[model samples]
Target chain A: GESVGLHLPTLSVQEGDNSIINCAYSNSASDYFIWYKQESGKGPQFIIDIRSNMDKRQGQRVTVLLNKTVKHLSLQIAATQPGDSAVYFCAENAGSYIPTFGRGTSLIVHP
Target chain B: EAGVAQSPRYKIIEKRQSVAFWCNPISGHATLYWYQQILGQGPKLLIQFQNNGVVDDSQLPKDRFSAERLKGVDSTLKIQPAKLEDSAVYLCASSLVASGNGGEQFFGPGTRLTVL
Candidate 1:
């Protein structure tokens, strides 16, 4: 079965520094991708999404970069804040009605 | 507008017992989904519904789990003879079918189940 995976399980960054999380997907047919942020004991919240047609999409202080050539995706957070720390997940939809998710990356911001 | 809603913030049940979780999607949304998230993992789609009909349920454990969206409004998921491994957070989400070719999902607070 095809799978989506993250390069790291945990990340630590300074409160004011930029944060980058990486993900790799196995299915080439995946045309849509989404990034979700989940706080402790809460459901996932939509962050940003990118279609296969575009390479990048920016929203607020977050940017999603998609490299279809390598089946890689990344989420970049500018000026990281305490509230930005959470578990991030990357999901891929490959013509299927449902989306598959990655293991998840735990982001920790140091004050 | 209200987001997706789920009941029983937390549940503790013993093995072989039955449990049911409820969900209410955003008003007027045509697409609904149920996902299971284990600790340290992302959400996994269990079932999908379009209106009152089931769109996909390939990942659902049909032997022990069943779901229905009555009147295409609210939905419920029931797990009969639950096992210890069934413990996880159940999340319900909805998306507007008219938003885009690939709609974005809005999630609920989730129901955390702990099987003892």
Candidate 2:
């Protein structure tokens, strides 16, 4: 079965520190990946995305890295803030317009 | 621009009952999607629609869940004879189109369904 998964279920970091979240996909054909931040009582919000053709992409204060060989993806947030505390999800797309999401990683930023 | 809109922010029903959720996507978005988010898990795609036409419903539990988008605008999702396991948050999202790189989706506040 095709699936997207995360390397960590939860991560706690001190405020102002950098945070990294990792994900792995079983399907090598997956070409697009996206990171989403979800707050409690709300819907998931798009953070950033990376196409398979590219190895890295940066947004606001975040960076997404794609390693096609290992079928791995990572998201790095610089200067993590308490506001960054949320459940992070990674989704994979394989030419299909609909992407599949992995189990989210809960990030708790301490003040 | 207004984000996606969902009605009945919270719903409570007994098992074997029926409930319906409504969603109004951003004004001009041509694509709409419905997802189910279980506790401690990520949102799972239930259905995808492209301008009133269903693009995908592979993950939807057809036996009890049904959805439709009419006039290529507002949409509704209905669950008949809801089960206890059906307790979850139902999220609605919309995108500009299926083409190009800017097909980013915007989500609504979602309707939390609690099955008793």
Best DockQ goes to which candidate? 2
User: Which ranges in model 2 have alpha carbons more than 4 Å from their true place?
Assistant: B99-102
Q: lDDT by residue for model 1 over B54-104, one digit each (tens)?
A: 989999999999999989999999999899999999999999872235787
Q: List, residue by residue over A35-102, the lDDT tens digit for candidate 2.
A: 99999999999999988999999999999999999999999999999999999999988887778899
Per-candidate DockQ values are 0.62, 0.65
Once superposed on the true structure, which residue ranges of model 1 sit more than 4 Å away at CA? Answer: B98-100
TM-score of each candidate?
A: 0.97, 0.98
lDDT tens digits, residues B56-83, model 2? 9999999999999989999999999899
Q: Mind giving the per-residue lDDT tens digits that candidate 1 earns over A1-107?
A: 78999999999999999999999999999998999999998888989999999999999999999999999999999999999999999998877656889999999
* Total clashing pairs for each candidate: 0, 0
TM-score of 2: 0.98
RMSD in Å for model 1 = 1.2
If you superpose only chain B onto the true chain B, what TM-score does each candidate give? 0.96, 0.96
Residue pairs of candidate 1 with colliding backbone atoms: none
